[model samples]
Target: MNDSGRAERRETVAEHKRTIILDAARAVFEAEGLQGASMRMIAKAAGYTPGAIYAYFPSKEHIYAAALGESLERLKAATEAAVATGTPAQRFVAAGLAFFDFYDTNPRDLDLGFYLFRGGIHPQGLSVDLNAELNTKLLATLEPLRVAVLDDGAGADRARVVTADVLAHASGLLLLAHTKRLALFGGDARAMMRTHLCERLARGNTPESG
Candidate 1:
């Protein structure tokens, strides 16, 4: 093989190994969380030695961040798909619900995305850059809904505010529903979200000055 071909082949092999390590790291993070998980655990899960794992990922935090990035990509795809066919208002609502459903249906993924079982907001060992990148990925998943709101005639600032409100509402509802607290009020989270979105749309349709 030419040197260029050899180099491409080597790169492919490296990526494959990195993926194996990441897959193993994800399982370990799921089981033990960032605080409790160790490189040793990930290596064991991948059937590789600690040294071998290190050759691909510098630390468990890097692996955790990479895995979270993948989860966010899936989230982005789901929301993007939801907005592909509907009126602006309909697309806005669908994307919001899609985001909520992604988490509600995949409770483990919710846990992973929010670091619920892990370290929460202050995950240990993540660099500032890693944290910022992960946060960016998370917000990108919400961008479609924000764009839909903008298309519905809300100004940029208004669109941002409305998007934030939707995200907060969805996250709060999911937390309550998952913890069974919503049951206390005889509330269905999905139904409540539908009602909330309808109300927001109604308000957005009204004439506003200022």
Candidate 2:
């Protein structure tokens, strides 16, 4: 191969290895969480020696960051798909349910995204803002909700407030359902979301509603 071709081939191989390491890292992180999971465990899962994993990901924290970023992408996709169809109000309902359902099915992902164990600290060789990009990606998923909630001609600030409220409601529901606390109220995530949407709609349509 030409020199340039050889370089491209090497780059491709490196990317492939990184992808493999990240795939294994996600599985390990899912099973063991951030603090408990180890690079050796991830290497074993990836069918590589411990030293091999270190070549692609210098530390478990970097692997965790990559894994969480992947999860965040899926979460964003799910939320976007949910809000893609229906009327504004219908889209609102779909968006809320999507958030609940995504987390309900992938509780570990919820923990990863919400920083259950990772928290605000950074490990060696990882940026303090390692998860910052994922947070921005997650936040961008709120646009659909903003569009669904705001009345026509609504100001940006109002959209922000409404979107925040909707997100808070959805996040709260998922957290409760994940902890099995929602069961005490005789509802699953879907039921809670549906009821919350109904209440919001009622208040929105009422003559004296804010």
Candidate 3:
């Protein structure tokens, strides 16, 4: 191969190794729990030496961040897919439903991204600001829906609040469902999600349904 061709191949190989490291680290974190999961375990799972794993991710906390970043990317893809083609109201509600469906079906991804177990999980080896930055990425994932909501003519601040509120409510409901506590309130988590969006749409003078 030419030098340029060799360089491209090298980049591809590097990306492949990074992906392998991320998948293995995520699995180890899930299987062992963050507290018990170690770099040696992740290295073994990835078929790499501990030093090699560290070459890619400086610490378990960084691997956890990457795992969470992938979860957010998956969510962004799903929500954007739902937003792809719908009436404004339909698209808005679809985005919310997409978020709920993701958490419901991919509980592992949810747990990795959100602290679902309440106190059982905690970040390790990370500064406070680094952790806060993760939520900023989460909000960026929802920006498209917020814009769709504002297309319904919600003012700037209100549209932002509405989007935040919908996500907040969905997170709460999903958390309850994950903890098996939603049933105690006679809540159908999925239905409640749709109804909540519909109500919000109605209040905003947008169509309640597609």
Residue pairs with backbone atoms closer than 3 Å in model 3 (clashes): none
Q: Identify the leading candidate in terms of lDDT.
A: 1
Return the lDDT, model 2, position 21. 89
Clashes of each: 0, 0, 0
Error of 2 at 191 (Å): 1.6
At residue 204, candidate 2 shows an lDDT of 65
Candidate 2: the clashing residue pairs are none
Q: Tens digits of per-residue lDDT for model 1 on 1-210?
A: 999999999999999988898888878887787989999999999899999988888989888888889889999999999999989999988999999999999887787777876556455678999989998998899999999988888888888888888999999999899889999999999999989988888886423722
TM-score for predicted model 1 compared with the true structure: 0.88
Reference-based lDDT, residue 7, model 3: 98
RMSD of 1: 2.5
Best by TM-score: 1
User: lDDT of each structure?
Assistant: 0.88, 0.75, 0.83
